[model samples]
Target: MLENPAPPPRTSPATLDPSAAGAGVPCRAHPERTRIGNRPARRRRAARIGVPTDSPELNWLRQSLRACDLLASVHSISPSDRALVAFAIEWAPYGGADTEDLFIKFGAQRNRFLHLLQAAMIPRPSDLGHLRNLKTTLCNDLLRAWNDTPPHNEKQCRRL
Candidate 1:
């Protein structure tokens, strides 16, 4: 057999540098101005007041008051009335213990203050065993009255 013809000369591909190949073209990317691989630092917020960390009932009431739409109604009432209602929210499940003080502070007779509280939609738990339930119902009523939402049927409420 005839010897194989001499191998053809090998041709090597040339590599091009990106910077040299695109010298006249401008890049629109502004990588330095935007965040990359690093998250923005979170600002710390102040702690909320009026609820003990250990008490679930107080915590729920505080959260409900913040989220409820009845806030407008609270603002529409007189300032003293508003203060009493706020105090009641903080003293829920135990408003009876503070009745005398509530009376003095509001500068109203017991019956008058009671009527005011009822009218203001202030909540008070009627039974020790169902304190949480009562608070939840109060929150639900507030939500329904102004927000048109149903009561929370969460497991925490059922546990009460």
Candidate 2:
């Protein structure tokens, strides 16, 4: 009979700092205050993609935006990457609540800005719900519109 493997070493809970466990520190340039516990797990997962610890929040945002930009670059340079265009569209609209104020503080202009958001096809409504109510509403409306639009392209259709 094979011997049982020993259990992994136990970590002390006391050593774990919940405040720092998954929280992001805000960049000095952004006007918003950094709250330690406000980040959702999905955001945390997305943020880990290309963000470095010392990078500013602006830099992090830029990196997130770059995912879409890279997809565009791929599509422009190589048609083969068209397969990933859907993912690119999804990434473009997959921002968190952190940037809402910067975009929506303009009041009347916010509607126009939201329209631009509607153009980026996202993959999931639950992902949209991770944002604020206004953003979620806009995303849901755009999703419905996409579903209603003719020329049914399975590649472009997002599963809510």
The candidate that wins on TM-score is: 1
lDDT of 2 by residue, 1-160 (tens): 9986998888777448777654675555643434333345535766788644445644444443444344345332133333223322233333322235424532323334433444443434443332334333334533433344433443332332
* Model 1 vs. true fold: TM: 0.36
Q: Which stretches of candidate 2 lie over 4 Å from their true place?
A: 1-53, 76-108, 123-160
The list of candidate 1 runs beyond 4 A from truth reads 1-54, 67-70, 73-78, 122-160
The sequence of per-residue lDDT tens digits that candidate 1 reaches over residues 26-50 is: 5566433332221121111112443
Looking at model 1, residue 31 earns an lDDT score of 32
What TM-score, over all chains together, does every model reach?
0.36, 0.23
For residue 109, model 1's alpha carbon misses the true position, in angstroms, by: 4.0
Q: Give the C-alpha miss distance for residue 45 in model 2, angstroms.
A: 30
lDDT of model 1 at residue 80?
58
